[model samples]
Target: MKMRIVPIGDQATLGDHRHYPGARLLLVCSLCGWDKAYRAERVIDRLRELKSGGHATRLEQVARRVAWNCPGCGRVKWRCHFAWPPGFDDREAKRLANLYRN
Candidate 1:
């Protein structure tokens, strides 16, 4: 399966294949931080790791909730930039992207 990596300025959001079905193998996006590339499953693994470490990131952020982050203060506050999913609105994701690309 081809990796489906949603592009971002620094990191790409990973879509889970094993959990979400029809998932790609490796998500290749220069925006994807930490590593040059990332596997969808691997992203989940790391998120879970941090969760176990008491630095849990929300699933929405894990699912690409937001792209813009306050880099200056983020390092000190953990995943403070992440926002909670307001509700079911796939279009919101698109709107967010539209706002970003423009």
Candidate 2:
């Protein structure tokens, strides 16, 4: 699979998760060195519960809807990126899990 890096200013939507299965969103605070990883699906679900209509929400637009401030420093200097775990293959993992089993 080809890996694509979408610029922060690009219009990559939450729904793009379909194209990059198992990808996670990594948020890092430049001021305080705080960092965390969020599953794409959970983020989407949370946005839906908040009635934010996230499926069509662009990745660049999420900062406006979600709080990106660093909890430790109370600053909004954040760096966000889409990432996958080291040496983890999404396709192989899905195949082994048999997610469609009834």
Candidate 3:
């Protein structure tokens, strides 16, 4: 999978993803080259409530269980990455596996 670089200052508009109460999660779509900051807590809570799997805490773990369709291409096989704050490096972005994508 290729990592898409999320431009600086663009993370604020990704989505409702937030790591903490006020913090957000920066993510990138390796397939479509799309990137955004999503509201982590809200998405996680919703996923836990909607999906049959048990609760997941980590970003990658949560993504694995959640139903995420890429807004760029509407594909379900997309992966999400944690864009470490301060410096958004494509090499360091962690990949969330979509085991069910077919």
Candidate 4:
């Protein structure tokens, strides 16, 4: 199955994955050019383990709450987004990409 990248809105929470099935978290660091995609379920479980409110945590809040610091530069800059199952949409992807440009 093809996967499509989804723009994570400011109001999005970890639990929101239920509304968009097969979605994953995409974390990007602009400063160091570091990026990683994580499975949403795994992230939720990890958050629960850390006692950080798990699914209730908003995507925007994740950077502050999680250790998303760039490994290369050790900076705490991140652009959070989502990846979902479906065919890719170039237009939507481009728009989402632009939203994180600094």
Give the candidate number with the greatest lDDT. Answer: 4
**Clash number for each model:** 2, 0, 8, 0
Per-residue lDDT for 1-102 in model 4, tens only? 534557666888888876555557877776876767788888889888888778888887876665655788898878667776456566655665666453
- lDDT of each candidate versus the true structure: 0.35, 0.66, 0.47, 0.72
Per-residue lDDT tens digits for candidate 1, residues 1-102, read 222332223332333232322223331122323212334455567767766311233333543433444344332111211122225245755666576567
What's the C-alpha lDDT at position 69 in model 1?
Answer: 44
TM-scores of all models? 0.26, 0.66, 0.41, 0.67
- From the highest lDDT down, the ranking of the candidates is 4, 2, 3, 1
lDDT at position 12, candidate 1: 27
Evaluate candidate 3 by giving its C-alpha RMSD to the native, one decimal.
12.9
Q: Name model 4 segments beyond 4 Å from true.
A: 1-4, 85-102
Question: What is the number of residue pairs that collide in model 1?
Answer: 2
Pick by TM-score: which candidate is best?
4
Candidate 3 on 14-49: residue-level lDDT in tens?
232322122345455556766666556556666668
TM-score of 1: 0.26
lDDT of 2 by residue, 1-102 (tens): 322333444567777766655567766676786767787788889989989767787776665555656788988877556766566675755864565332
